[model samples]
Target: MKESIFHRLYDTYHQDVFQFLIYLVKNRSVAEDLSHEVYVRVLKSYDRFEGKSSEKTWLFAIAKNVAIDYFRKSSVRSSRTFDAFDWETNQLVSPTKSPDALVELNDDMQELLLALEKCTGDQKMVIVMRYFQELSIAETAEILNWTEGKVKTTQHRAIKHLRELLTNDTVKEAKSHESK
Candidate 1:
């Protein structure tokens, strides 16, 4: 009975939970460990789930908290690294060819991800939840235990910051290519 319930939850949300952790922790093994910890916590608190939020939101809330705890405990610097990024340019491209186009899209995504690294922690959280994870403002606020206004404000600032970073990076890349 317990096993089945857990399996169901895992089947439904494990990938999302893992991706959230990976975004927060910037480490795969750490994210995996943290993912396991999230399920453990879910198992412990399964009966207490009040359905106030969707189960997905509830899981994300737990994941956000678990990530907070991990950060508090971790001594390492929070310098963001996505050496193990898992992304496909499916959404950014058509069902077309042209290897050059694919490479350009990948470069653009790389630049964007790198820009995300430069955002403040709040900005990063807001961007990841609101954009990367595609959570609604209400859901993002709930998971972060913030007001919707705060989420919106942070997301706005994050986008502005990302735009600045990407613009600068693109100019730099262009100048470097021109020099070559």
Candidate 2:
């Protein structure tokens, strides 16, 4: 039974979980490690799962906590005074996509990813779950331990922020090219 559950989770959620982690971390190797951690957590807690939420949301919840823990530990280790989860960095790195995916990612998509990096952690999480992962509002709320209303509000704010960021970037690029 345990083996079957393991197989089912691997078959169903492995890629989605990895993608979610990769989007958050902006690094392939780190996402893989986090994905593994999520799987381990689910397996350990499977028996205790009360079925109040769907398996997907439960898995995502584990992934979300794992990411928060990673950022916290990283911040502590680096002696950063600020909360890393909410810190915005202009030098935020782009997420690593497969070669095939890289070929498909255009300038707009790159800009969008950068804009996403500038968002607060809650905004980013809401966007990634609602848009990137194609999860419903309720699922996102369950995963984030928030209300559906909060999820909708965060997503709206995130989209508006992204639009502003992308528009400004575009204007700057156009001006630079004109100057050249």
Candidate 3:
């Protein structure tokens, strides 16, 4: 039973957890390593899982905690590693694509990514889980081990901050274009 449960969770939530960690950390390699670490911790704590929450919720809660621990231990260093996948990559496509389409896509992607970078970690996690990962509010709260109210507040703040960043960016771009 224990092994079956572990297998089930591994299959069900592995990809979601990986994607979540990738967005949070903004690095593919770190996300992959942390995803594996999350599972290891989950396996060790599997026996301690009481029935207080659903299995999915419990697993995500563990993942969230692992992410927090990772951030706590990690030091922020300037690195160009993740820049390979930055918004500019979205502009490049096969010969089949039109130049206008590429330009529009790149502009939109750049704005979104820039806005995302401006968000606080707490706000970013909420946005990533809820919007990017498509988790429900309850599930998000469960994963973050936060109250529903807290989740809602974080979501609001995230959106507000993102909007401000986008607005400011747009103004700057317009001003630069006008100057040119």
lDDT of each: 0.74, 0.80, 0.71
Clashing pairs in 3: none
Model 3, residue 82: C-alpha shift (Å): 26
Model 1 lDDT, residue 40, Cα: 95
Each model's TM-score, in the order given?
0.77, 0.88, 0.78
Give candidate 2 regions above 4 Å deviation. 80-104
Cα-based RMSD of the predictions, in order? 9.0, 3.2, 8.6
lDDT of 2: 0.80
Candidate 1 residue lDDT tens string, 71-180: 54442334254232112110112112222322445767656765776677678777878777899999999887889998898889889989988888889988999999
- Give the range where candidate 2 is weakest over 10 consecutive residues by summed lDDT: 87-96
Score residue 3 of candidate 3 by CA lDDT: 83
Higher-scoring candidate on lDDT, 2 or 3: 2
What shift in Å separates residue 129 of candidate 2 from its native position after superposition? 0.6
- List the candidate 3 regions with Cα displacement exceeding 4 Å: 76-107
Ranked by lDDT, the better of candidates 1 and 2 is 2
